[model samples]
Target: MTANVNIAIKHTSLLISGALLGLLHAGLANASGYPVTVQSCDRQVTFDHAPKAAVSNDVNLTEMMLALGLQDHMAGFTGVSGWKTLDPTLRNGIGELKELSPKYPSKEVLLGADADFYFAGWNYGMRVGGGVTPDTLAPLGIKVYELTESCIHIMDKPKVSMDDLYIDLLNLGRIFDKEEQAQSLVKGYQEDLTNFQANLTPLKTIPKVFVYDSGEEQPFTSGRYGMPTALIEAAGGKNIVDDVQKSWTQIGWEAVIDRAPEFIIIVNYGDVTAEQKINFLRSNPAFKNIPAVKNNHFVILEYIEATPGPRNINAIKRLAEAFRTAL
Candidate 1:
């Protein structure tokens, strides 16, 4: 057999031995109320115990792991270059960990790392037909946990909410045996959100906000189902494309011009900088009449902040401050 096969076989053998020991110490497992199972994207995954060697994929998932201070549990990570944009505190935590790859690693690469758990979500770490799909990794004794926000696109979820972030943190806490830490984190975010909402009571005018993800031909924007909608609503503003229904979508510039947004929210990610988007809006003659472009009323939010995670509360606070000042 080849070296990879040999490694897989050896890992499989070790897993069997560990599982048998776990069964023998059933009381110990029960002591923590594990073999806890969580449902993700219409599938169920059970965790017998905290993962000893975990691999975090994507910026949101990586931040979640780091926020919970689970770097010791993580073997490595991949996907996204948010470290350059992350806050210094969080960036320091990530700086200490090994980056398995700059992008999503293939099945063989993942297997080679000997990861017992994968902190990932649909279309984030494992794509629909990607070789390292959760289903494929299950037989190899790896558990995959999907981030709750990504579930809106992958599953038949009703809509996106701030609760998604809570549940994700709570679930991660459970997996890592850090339920108390999770609760504390969720409580803190909830408190911050409550404060933000309370501060909005004095504001009478809610700006018509346009979220700019990217695209010169047609702007990619967040719809009612994305986290941005919640952020906008929480920040005392309205999303012009709130009727789109999908998480992120492409809408024609004419549609945007018709709506005539007063505030523009730029999503900072990919190759496109927030300045580039702002410049595009300023330079285009078609956007000359638009209130947001005319007044240069643009709020630049980091891509990580726009997504569902620890940074969401920060996004809300920043947007709230901006709206109050702009309006």
Candidate 2:
């Protein structure tokens, strides 16, 4: 097997083990209570009781909540990324909530909503400039749970894996007292993953792939670790810049030419069309001669799906299909 496939197999195995361990621990935890304190994102948040009203600051949290069938408990949402495509019912609900603005309702609005709990996908939304701090919300009897994968600077280090997605689902299930529903959802995801894996053919070779995301002045590319690496492997391609440790890194034009990737996935963000992306690459003197450009083997995916979350599975499938067709 190629190195990328080996890496993917090893990574998937480790994630499975870690997920099993996590599920075991979660199973043993005391479940009988009005509320529980779960440590996430380097913070200990005690949910004194099952929250009746809640607000989400990130789309992942919203997705998780809706998946857990806890939408009825959601009071509002703020700072959601515009890239995500939500379920029709959830989108309509958000529209109604926006019209209401029932309480604290700004990108900076975190208080005055009188929500019993606050769940954020990224802690950056609650940091200094984020309009609401945990301390400020705590005084009003509101608690916050920040998604562990998005936590950047934590000493103890939360383990992140593809399984963390399922763990997040289960955790939300616990919070909403929908354990059965959560299990069912996790099972469905596992089945989806299994089906995808079964469809995988033993790779004869790992195709070279380049991930071009937003960056007009300086291009952003996936590094060795994190979501992009996972996505690349899943798509049956190898990231040209996989030696770097960071999730993403800036690389010069010369390095990209040297790699000479066979396929390029241009991550579409904010008002950028696929044709515009192709034009941008063709206009770049440095990239004009690359095989990807010459062969027109470029694909565009939404920025939100490219990030880590439930949408990542969709991104992987789309990417795999795109590469398969191009190859």
Candidate 3:
């Protein structure tokens, strides 16, 4: 070949190589920033990439993933009852995903799915002694993103609020490179809260609220730290059990009678329906003369909203409207 032609070819090859090298460096920088590490529960969780195969335990976390448009990334799921209670649009998308179990899957089942990430909370998915935990799974290449509300006991944040939902969504967005979507969703929630609070101007009195989770012998209720406490306060209702200083606790009927709450918030989930709880309250003579029972004032919320998720804002809106009307 002519010397001039050889020199031209060499110059072209060098330019192409330089361009490719620059692209590779940029990609590496992005990768390094990713699989981002955050302290979850008591340990550090690293997301190497947005999980391609993910599993969500329980309906609350499942709906959270769905709301983020991350269902396509779900490899499998469990906790079927919550799925049944989801909105029609959300329910329609579940036909394709694999259901690992009706309840918490065994450790072997979780391993078999080879999920890159597991969206679950302690007790809600895998119990502590079951041998499957974030620490145990980390070595096997599966990391866990725990539901934030479930972490109050383990983390520095000991209270629950809409902030829990905001942080969880934002973290998921960062993991998936969808920060814009996360921020947009949070903004919408903030706007809804602001608008709802503005409409509460006419509420002259704050109702005393009794949150009913379950139990015939003892009434389970939202204590100082659960989402219900935050929701009740936001709705202009003072929680009668706010002094308990725990998430959900069982209180005596006499204590409830003494409180004489004007409103009762019944949680809808598990084997017992909200109607059953209301029935129990009405049938029991101990509750017969309670102001809430006498007035038929009860706000029924799905257990899903009782936890932290996108539906929490809806819970706030519903309670606010009910309180406004009742006032």
Best by lDDT: 1
Ranking 1 against 2 by TM-score, winner: 1
Better of 2 and 3 by TM-score: 3
Per-residue lDDT of candidate 2, residues 77-175 (tens digit): 765545434446557545555411322344334445667777764432455445565666677777777665555433333333566566666666667
Candidate 3 Cα outliers beyond 4 Å, as residue runs:
1-33, 82-87
Ranking by TM-score: 1, 3, 2
- The residue-by-residue lDDT of candidate 1 on 1-327, one tens digit each, is 233333432332222233223322432344466777665667777787899989988777789888898988988888865333445666687876777877887777677889999878766777777688778998998888887767766666755667667777777777777776876787777776775555353455557899998999988899878889878776767789988877877889999999999999998877778899899999999999999999989999987789877899889889878877877
Off by over 4 Å in 1: 1-31, 82-87
Which candidate achieves the best TM-score against the true structure? 1
| Better by lDDT, candidate 3 or 2 | 3
Q: State TM-scores per candidate.
A: 0.85, 0.81, 0.84
Instruction: Please estimate how well model 3 matches the true structure, expressed as its whole-model Cα lDDT.
Output: 0.73
| Best-first order by lDDT | 1, 3, 2
Residue-level lDDT of model 3, residues 1-327, one tens digit each, is 233333322332222233223323333345446756554566666666788888998877887788788877888888765434544655776768878877787667777887888888865686665676787787888888887667755555555555666667766776666666766776677777766565454455657888998889887888877878777766656788888867777889899999999899998877788899898889888888899999999999988888777788789778877877775
